[model samples]
Target: MGELMGRAVQRVSHEHREMAAERLRAAAGDGLISIDELDRRLGTAFLAVTFADLDAVTVDLPPAPLEVVAAAASRRVLRLAVSNGSVSRFGEWEVPGEIELQLEHATSTLDFRVSEVPATGVHINVQAFRSRVRLLVLPGTYVDLGSLGRHRSTVADRHGRAGSSRELHAVRLTGDIRGGSLRVLRRPYQLF
Candidate 1:
């Protein structure tokens, strides 16, 4: 009876090992497991070949295709129009090539950076009071800021090269900025 019990335990252990191998193979094919990671996991399995050991292995499984889910979640577009107030403490805004912005009714401090803009156009119109607006533009891009008003405003093109592309992208900002601040950073691509 003792020998029989030992044999039964050995059989269960082998079954657990086989199950682990199968899971490892599936995970590898699914691109969830690198060969080195798989080897490490298998080594851990070999050290302890019981049901509880296998359960622990299953618990440590790497996430599956989470990038697609994350990208989908972070991708967004915003069109905001604020009126009859002062917008202060606006920070750097980066605009990617794929991003589209139509902003109007902004009143306050405005600081903006424009880089790597792949879009065909953008429209901005803003009004400010005792606020400073700054814009930085990249090379080979066009930006049209319609009617900007403020205590101080500066448009600087650091690319040092004349923009050869005559394709005018329009940004229209229309509002009143009274005693506040706004800053925007624009990138070549649309970012979340």
Candidate 2:
């Protein structure tokens, strides 16, 4: 649990830092900060390596508009339960803060490529009994199976079992899998 919490303070990508810096610039334009403050925050934002560091750059700025805030908060959790059947969640869906999946002798497919990921990341708890769950995620997102323990169920990832860079959004999976299987695959990059 301690390790998980430590990992939660994730390193953010350069793009994310740049976005935060842009937001700071926007805020300054709105008179939230002076020109000098904007320059200072912009410098800090570019130098920020972690999400927390970038967040600090404009933490004192005014909140976003109500509509945007509501829309973001609305994408909370996606819960699904199945018994002896196949369930699929994909395409233009919002990846919630937590995905709770309960399966009993069933199969599930979850695709995150076409989904919107939350800023803080996502957590997936799959409780299975004699079922199989297939999770298709984006390139940077990782699947951590450390807490899965020694159940009859097995977790396999075609890309690799090791966690990706901390800069990527993390999907922490924790649950009991008795006589079931969990497969995590990274989607192929598409150029369109």
lDDT of 2 by residue, 88-164 (tens): 88666656667889899999988877765655456778788999888888765667766664387677876755654
Per-residue lDDT over 84-126 for candidate 1, one digit per residue giving the tens place of the 0 to 100 score: 5444323445432222222233443333333222223334444
Q: What is the C-alpha lDDT of each candidate?
A: 0.45, 0.71
The candidate scoring highest on lDDT is 2
TM per model? 0.27, 0.58
Lowest lDDT 10-mer window, candidate 1? 95-104
Candidate 1 TM-score, true structure as reference: 0.27
Off by over 4 Å in 2: 1-75, 161-168, 189-192
* TM-score leader: 2
lDDT (Cα, 0-100) at 81 in candidate 1: 38
